[model samples]
Target: MKDVIVIGAGPSGSYAAYRLSKMGLDVLLLEEHKEVGKPVECTGLVSKRVLDFVKTRSIAGKVYGANIYFPNGKSIHVEKNDETIVLYRDSFDKDVAAMAIGAGADIRINARAISVKENNDSVTVKYRDSGQLKEDNAKVVIGADGINSVVRRDLYRIRQEKVVSTLQYDMAGKIEDERSVNVYLGSKYTHGFFGWAVPGGEIIRVGTGSYRASAYPYMKALSKRFGTNRVLGITGAGIPIKIAKSLFTKRSVLIGDAGGIVKPLSGGGIYTGIFSANLASERVANAIENEDYSQLRHYDKDIRGSIGVELKKDGFIQSIYSKIGDRSFDRIYGLISSEKIIDTINRSGDIDYPSKVIFKVLIRNPALLYSMWK
Candidate 1:
């Protein structure tokens, strides 16, 4: 039996395995795909804080700011000294998994976990490997899987309440400003979410998310508005806008998208997921070494104490953002487009903790609150 079993070799899983194995624990990392990060679905835009978690070489491009467009044709520009790293997501996943393997964690590719059963002393995972049935036993199981996680569903009987279906195309064409991303905000473009155009080196990634209907039509419309529809590649993903209520059980815990540990505003999970994984590794190690399985509950408490505060705020903001119509968005944009508010945003805006700017803006211009109410 292994000391720890990490399902799904994404950044969170790989990082957890890497940390535990480095501590001399017998860890097993499993990947369903033959390759580590194949069928990439992410826009790959992440903050520099990701570097603090893992040193990587999957950088594709960098942008220093964002241009947010409202439905009324007005926009707000926010810039910062720090740049957002556009990653080659496939290479990024491979890099993290390599770190785990280097740290003595055994990894199995083409391994799909079908079911997980938690016993009093250990957890058993049944999976299909190369079309053959296999099983592994571990003192603790960490479900670092994606949004549609078998471990989360089978073990916890949990499901995401609301998820945004997104679609994007990598278009080969000219980009207006490669230094900044373009954000289109409105229910007209996307019902529950918004549209985005992120510049890569040679291609611009154009995508949209929808809550009421298909995101394809909205994405196509967004690509048309951007004036570049020549496609290079296409990708789609589902983002859980709400965090899961239950993340830990007797002998198992879910991390990353599986636990809905993503940002509600931006739907970015890398930083938060890996951050939780780091915390989880400590708790898991302590539980195993101390032989107190109940200690695993602290992982949930630890997460709620840290990023959970930020996620809670972001979720409240998203609830309003999703329900607001184009008129409200236009009004909000007009109210916040001032030089003073822009400066406040530029100073406080963080991709990882986005709600900071909103609070700061409200504090500076209390009129914005009345404007929101109206």
Candidate 2:
């Protein structure tokens, strides 16, 4: 039996396998897709902190600021020194998978995990590869599968969170400002969420997500507004909005979207997923070395303690947006477009962790509270 069996080959699974392999654990990474990255669903906008895990060679563009458009055609521009990179997710996933393989973890492609059964001492993973069914036993099982996870379904019975439907298109066009991303805020455009245009090397990616709206019409409208002609590629996926009720059981754990750790506001999961995976690896290693599978519970506690508060706060903010209309957003934008608020955001804003600077901004402009709450 292997020390660990990871059920997905995305960044989360690959990174967890890499970390476990580095710790000298026997790890097997499985990928359902034939290739590591294909039919990409993410916007691939990542902060510099992601560089610590993988070295990316294909950078579509870099964003140093954001232009937030309000309902009434008014906009607020926030600039920062730290830049966010638009990655080619295909290359990024391959890079992480290569790192895992280099660290002695075995990777199998076209292997889809169908079910998982936990015994007292070990866990068995049933999978199908090339039309052949196979089973593998591991001291621990880590489910890094995407939003629709079989592993999660097999291990525990918990209430699943709502999934946000997203649609994006890669259009052939020249963006006015490649260094800045554009976000459109209005119920007409995105329902409760927002529409975004991210510049790539030769194409601009325009997309949107919402809990109660269809994204295709919004994406089409955004593409028309951008005056883009050719659509090079299109992809869509369901993003989990809430964290899972339980992240682990006795001998099995879920990471990444399977754990529903995707950021509530931005729908970004790479950073949080990797963060959870890193924490899981430590606990998994300890569980294996000591022969006590209960140590896996630490992974759940650590993830919740580290990111649970942020997720809850973000969810609340999203709920506020969902309840309000366009005029309310315009009023809120009028209050936040000031130099003081903009300067504060430029100085302390973060895409991954917005709560860090949100409180400070709220403290500076108390009137904004009245706008949101009232």
Candidate 3:
């Protein structure tokens, strides 16, 4: 039996495998797809903190500012000192997989994990590979599979609080502001969330998300406004919105989307997933070395103390965002767009922890806080 078996070769899973393998544990990494990364589902816009995880060659472009548009036809441009990196997700995934492989982890492509059964002392993962069924036993199992993770559903039998349907397209066109991403907010356009146009070098990525309705109509409208119909690629999927009740249980643990640990406001999971996976790896490694699987509970506690704090803050912001009407949004926009408030946002804005600037802005313009609630 191997020391660990990681289901899914995505960034989170691969990073966990990489860290565990580097710590002298025997790890097996499994990928469902024939290739490492394909059929991209993310917009690939991430904060600079992602650099702490892996070295990648998939950076497609960079932006230093954002233009947030309210429903009233006015917009607010917030510029930051640091640049956000746009990546070609396929290459990014492959880069993380390479690190895992180089760290002495055994990787298996075209291997789809169908079910995971955990016993008193070990975990058994049954999978399909090369048209045959197979099983592997390991001391521990990490579920980084994704939004519709089979391991999470089969093992925990739990679901996320909500799932947002998303639609995104990559279209080749000359963007007006290549240095800034455009964010559109309106109930008529995107019912539950927001829409965005992010420049990716020669192309632009346009996307949106909704609660129970289809996001395609909103995405089409946003794309049309940007004057882009020369579509290069299209991707659609459901993104889990909130964090799960728990992340680990005995010999099995969940990381990334499998644990529903996405940013409530932006739906970005790359940095958070990789970061959580790194933490899980440390705890799992310690548990294996001591043969005490109960130590896995610390993974959940550690994450809750660290990133979980940020997620909870963002969740409160999202709640305010979803409740505010368009008229109130425009009024609040007027307050936030002022030079003083804009300066505050520029000084403290952080995509990884957006609440930092938000609380500061609210403190400077207390009227804006009232508008958001009204």
- lDDT against the true structure, per candidate, is 0.89, 0.87, 0.89
Query: What digit string (tens of lDDT, one per residue) describes model 2 on residues 167-243?
Result: 89888886787889999888656867888989987888888887777887777777787775678889999898889
> For candidate 3, which ten residues in a row score worst on lDDT?
220-229
lDDT by residue for model 1 (1-374), tens? 99988999999999999999999999989889999998899898899999998899999999999999999988888999899999999999999999999999999999999999999889999998988999999999999989999888988998888798999888886578889999999876787788999998778888998875789878878888756538888899898877789888889988999999999998888998899899999999999999998988999999999999999999998887777778777888888999988998888889999998888888888877676656
lDDT of 1 at 63: 94
- Separately for all candidates shown, the number of backbone clashes (residues 3 or more apart, or on different chains) is 0, 0, 0
Regions of candidate 2 where Cα sits further than 4 Å from its true position = none
Q: Write the per-residue lDDT of candidate 3 for residues 117-146, one digit (tens) a residue.
A: 989888999999866899999999999999
How much RMSD separates candidate 3 from the native structure?
Answer: 1.1
Scored by Cα lDDT, where does model 2 land? Answer: 0.87
Superposing all C-alpha atoms, what RMSD in Å does each candidate have to the true structure?
A: 1.2, 1.3, 1.1
For each candidate in turn, the TM-score is: 0.97, 0.97, 0.98
